[model samples]
Target: MNTRFKQLLQLSAAALLVTSSSQALAWGQIGHRVTGEIAELYLDADTREKIAALFPNQSLAELSTQADSELSNPSEFWQQTWTWHFVTVPEGNEYSLDKHAPKEGDAYTALTSSTETLKDPKATVEEKRIALLFIVHLIGDLHQPLHSGNGTDRGGNDVKVEFFWQPSNLHRVWDSGIIDNQNLSYTELTKWLSQKITPQMASEWRTTDPKTWIKESIIIRDGIYPEEPKLTYDYQYQHIATIKQRLQQAGVRMAAYLNEVL
Candidate 1:
């Protein structure tokens, strides 16, 4: 092959890797970073200082996607953590920690455990580091309605659909399709979202409980499933507000949790 052809092939391979990897994750990088940015804005000075000490030079926005990045590694620990990004609760049934918890540890358990680890005074810096990263990422995951799934479709990953004439799935639509369609970087999206938050909205969203977050996702999930397998502009128009609302709630709640814990 010529040099140009080889370079083209390499680019194609890289694109394919990214596409496949994204299909398996929650909220995608942009969505997670957006959530992180919002949380960073709301974090109190003490919480920010504590987080800086743990991360040294990194900001929470930079660390927001670290859990997903770790998925690229082939370690056993990473394998075990694969399920921590979502939870499945079948339609018509309420989510109960005692009954619905996954054997492999889903997002709910992971978030709660990670928060505890961060709170522990004896936890090593490395342990706190991992826990904090998980908290940041999992909070974003918990907000994606599909992450708290109906249990029949693998969190909509199995429900293939065409979005704007492009092949996609219901889960992918919520995870990145809507956000990507906006064509904004994480910082831009954060600024836009920040401008909309009212004091009442902030007060209403600030909560430390992951279960409440999951329940809110469940309510949103109930209305989101399309009756058909094709989605386009109308679908985006109908659901975009919910997406923005969830992102804002995730950010506020994450900041609340971090502030209380730290």
Candidate 2:
């Protein structure tokens, strides 16, 4: 098989394995890969070469999901990273660095630190590797509206509901429930989205500021919560466009961020 064909098979297999094996988290494997796939399209040649030097074997699509999967680690380091996948702004307010800054650190803090680590000449290869991984995952997470949660409801994890008659929460619905319901592999979704993302859209979404990205998610977050306990096509219909846009934005912004830092 050709390389692109093999890559698609691998991505499909990975998506199936991760979806079946773990509880979905932070856009799950598919959304993470979708963002990564999109980012690869926009990465300049120099940035691509730099990343390839750092990671000869793994692609950005694979690394983008690593942080979320690492949550299964029993180490203190992993435990501390739980907050890094998300940030909570109150439902009514915009993100304020002062007020939203958690002592334990959140996505915003982690994104900044990771970027600095990657840019530091003194940093080790391992440090840069880990930083790049966080940068990829956190970019995807910040675009996920639920991850930019309100201080209440644990980013909608507490909001119980039935998604397509299955027991689910609002958070999972946004993460993977709706996407999963569509029955497309990450590669398929990525291909479709790649075709749809115009150069203008990519440019518009290419803001390098993580704070601006988080603020966008907050505005989307405040508007997405549903009053009804049962969700189906209507909910998915209303929000899938937002979901697609956020994924595309994350990818575009991630490329810009990486090109600037690396």
Candidate 3:
């Protein structure tokens, strides 16, 4: 093979690796965007105006994938934030911000810190901009049950499974498998979820603390693991409601958080 051809192949392989590995960390692009779009609907006029000013050329839905997009870029800052996409709480144990915090920081700390940054008047526009994007993405990540990992199995990334006869893992299955299978665009999913949210549901979901988000995820995470690693129609049927509910909650909570800070 020619040297240039070999190099091209090597780069393509590297890109594929990065894409697959990153998929395990959070809800996939469509899921995150759907959450962002839902949050956009709930934002108060003042909050929406401030966000528009902070991100002049972009919307929250557009910025929703920025944190994941940064993963492909090599830098100390991105490397240090590698762990912030998910939090690990072992099965049978509860998630506590004080006790369960990762040494490198996790989703909870990142969300809390980002919230403070956006709320601080002294924070620069650039600081608030980055914090807002991260907050948007991390809230979606926190809603993915697998993102609040069980101590073993790297958030189920190690639990090899076949999603609809294709080779995949439990984490990837939850991250995008079910949602992707439906073939809905982010906007379509957002619209569908919006119609389902009742006034009472919105009020209740909006008031939930982050700790409750994690705890609810942990409960859902526990019940989701299949006895066998092979997942098919039955698994999707059973867990689809949980997936929708989490997405809805993530969206409502995100709006609530932004309303408080912005």
- The per-residue C-alpha lDDT of model 1 at residue 212 equals 84
Report, for every candidate in turn, its global Cα lDDT versus the true structure.
Answer: 0.82, 0.81, 0.81
Q: Once model 3 is optimally superposed onto the true structure by TM-score, how far is the C-alpha of residue 169 displaced, in angstroms?
A: 0.3
Q: Of 2 and 3, which scores higher on TM-score?
A: 2
Model 2: lDDT to the true structure: 0.81
**Residue range 1-262, candidate 2, lDDT tens digits:** 2232223223332232232124347998899999999899989999999999988977889888877776665544554677878988887787787999787778888888777767878666666776788899899999999998887899999999999999999999999998888799999999988899898888788789888888888888888889899999899999998898888888888899999987
Ranking 1 against 3 by lDDT, winner: 1
Model 1 TM-score?
0.90
Return the lDDT, model 1, position 261.
85
| Residue-wise C-alpha lDDT for candidate 1, range 154-258, written one tens digit per residue | 999899999999999999999999999999998999899978999999998888878888888899999998999889989999999999988888888889989
TM-score of candidate 3 versus the correct structure, residues matched by position: 0.89
Which residue pairs come into collision in candidate 2?
none
In the order shown, the candidates' Cα RMSDs to the true structure are 9.5, 8.3, 8.6
What is the Cα-based lDDT of residue 86 in candidate 3?
89
Total clashes for model 2: 0
Give the residue spans of candidate 2 off by over 4 A.
Answer: 1-23
Off by over 4 Å in 3: 1-24
- For candidate 2, which ten residues in a row score worst on lDDT? 12-21
